[model samples]
Every structure is written in C-alpha cells, then in structure tokens.
Target: MKRLLILPLLALSLIACEKDDDSTTNDPGNNGNSNPSALTNNMISVGTDSTSLNKYSAYVATDVNTNKTYFDIFIYKDDVLDRKQYMLLHLTEIPTASKTLNWQSGANAPGAIKADEFVIYPKVNDKRWFGVYSVSGYETTGTMQATVNNGKLTLSYEDIELADEFISVNVTERKKCSGKLTFLLSDLQGLTTTAQTLDLVAE
Candidate 1:
C-alpha cells in the first residue's frame, strides 16, 4: 500500500512541473518581441444645428522600437440636405513642440507637405490624398498645428479643405473642416483611454 501511494505522489509532482513550464512560455508579457497594440476611442456629439449629425473617432499609437507617434481622426456627418460624407486626418512625425504643417498644390514647401509627412483625405474623389490612390488634379489644403505643453498635447485644424470640385467633391458646395483635440500625454501613456491610432497611409 505504501508503494502505491508513492507512485501517485510522483505522478502529481511531474504534472505540476509541466504546467509551470507551459505557463512561463506562453505568457505574453514575458515575450521580448511583443509590442503594444494601438489604442482607440469613439465619441459622439450633437451638431450645432438640429439637422446635423456628428461622429468622431480618434486613435493614438507609438512604436516601441522607433518611439514614433502616429495619430488619426475620422469625422462623419449626416443631414437632411443629403450631405453624407467622411473626413480623415492623419499625421506622421508629429512634432512634440508648437509647429504648424500645411499641404498645398504645385508648391515646394519643405517639411510642410509631403506624402510621408501629413495627409488629409476628404473623400472628395473617392481617392486618398497620399499613396497609390492619390488623385492627379485634386489637391489638399489644410493646416495641422500641434503643441506639447504642460504634459498635454493640443491639436488644432483650420479651414482644411480639398480642392477639385468635379470628381472629388461630387457636389456643387464645398466643405471646410476645423476642430480642436486636446488630451494629456500622461493619460495616453497610462493606457487610460482605449483610443489607438490607425495607419491609413503607408509611408
């Protein structure tokens, strides 16, 4: 009877050791190559007028290897006038200091407007402002200014519009976008918000 008891005890010990080994190997936090995922958030607000609908989505991400930051904002609007549209604003190499970036047509502005720097896609022609789908005649005109002060990030846009009335806008009337987004860098670092930036433009 003593021998039978000893055999069962030995088998239990072996099983426990196997489980411990598996747990250590499968732990995500222990993996050296694991990178943090993007954070994402959604917000809804009432439009200035009763007939308007406003929805905004924001995302923020930082690459652990390069420490580069990327941000994106999507705006959706609807109204009684059948004005259903979407606007996208993406930024790369975003300055942590107070600076303004702009993109225009047929002008050479260093660090201001480049395919790898900033993009504002208004869905004017069902094409993106950057990358392979970039429109030929369509041009993006906007200002993206950002400032990092007091451990907070302040982002603002002014009169950001897409020019090319025929194929891009698809409507006789033009649309102008302007807004402000402010949040604390500490909150983002803590992963307090679920907002994660998406890479709409590949550069």
Candidate 2:
C-alpha cells in the first residue's frame, strides 16, 4: 500500500499529520491537574463509529520557534476543528510519561503516525472540506498509545488494519478501528516540525 499522503504537510489537503521527535515538549505544567477540569466522558471510535468527545478546544502551535511542540486536539459540533465538523487528533512528541508508539504502513517517523495522519471530518453542520476522512497510524499495523497518569490523559489504538493504507479518503470500509481517547493532561492546550491535531495536540 502506498500511504504517502503526509498531506500538504502533515494534515489538511490530505489531512494534517505531523510527528516529530528528539522529544521534550511535555507541558500542561507537567501534569497532575495544574488546572485540568472540563471534558467528561470523552470518546473516539473510528470504524464502528462512536462519538462523544465534546466542545473541548485547544490549539498550541510551535515550529516557528522550535522546542518542537505542535500538539493539537479539537472535537466539534459547532466550529473550531479547522472550520467545523471534525475530529482532529494530532500528537507527535509531548507525552511526558507513559509511552508506546509502533505504527506501520507509510510510517511518518519522529514518533510515528504518518500516512494520512489521523484525521476525520464527520458531519455536524459541515465545513471541513465537506466530507473528510483519515486514520493512518501508519495505515495498517497499530499501537499508538499514550497514558499519562494523574493528569489523566488516555489516547489509544488497537487492531487498526483497515486497508488502502489504513484509509485517507475512504469514508468507512470497516475492517478494524479501535478507540479510547479520554482527556486531562490538565486539558491539553499544546507542536511542530510539524504533525496533527484534535480535540488532542502534543506533537
């Protein structure tokens, strides 16, 4: 499979996806709820199609300066996710603790999460290019985990194997799509040289 869609530059046209490394952008004041408190039952199921993640907004960008932090995470129902109807989860290197990254397919190095770079633009009063879609943790083989304790962040993945390079614009072919993306890390508001975004950014 040719999962070469690193987008116009990790997200958007082909949908944003940027994962950089040499690590060390973990902020949120270093976890343990410095101010965390808002989102409750957060959810993100790709294939079986589940939705819960609410109006949490966070867009921290860095690439113009470079401590290399391009973390983005935004859920939607009204607007925000690059113009509405979205589910952007772009994180590269910013998890202060608890780790696990092992994607395949067209693997975008730097903490890996390449290909289409984890995107989606489901409809809720539409906006994001009308009908958008993506979920490339390398596209096939998966395991992009992050579970920072205390400050309660929980991004996850599993069997992911839907093909065509794990999907870039394929809508829904459902072969595999795991989930579990809770929130906290003092409510992420963090990246780049560059990566992705969501209702969760910490690249």
Evaluate model 1: give its lDDT: 0.36
Cα displacement (angstroms), candidate 2, residue 26, comes to 32
Candidate 2 structure lDDT? 0.40
lDDT string, candidate 2, 1-203, tens digits: 11111222323332444211212221111111111132123444433445554444444434333344344444554334334344545554456676665443343332333432343223222212211124433333445566677776666654343322223554233334344556656545232222223343332
Worst 10 residues of 2 by lDDT: 26-35
The residue-level lDDT of candidate 2 at 154 comes to 66
Q: Compare the candidates by lDDT and give the number of the best one.
A: 2
Candidate 2 — which residues are off by over 4 angstroms?
A: 10-62, 65-84, 90-153, 156-179, 182-203
Clashes of 1: 12
Candidate 1 weakest ten by summed lDDT: 27-36
lDDT of 1 by residue, 43-73 (tens): 1111111111243344454423345544544
For candidate 2, the per-residue lDDT at 187 reads: 44
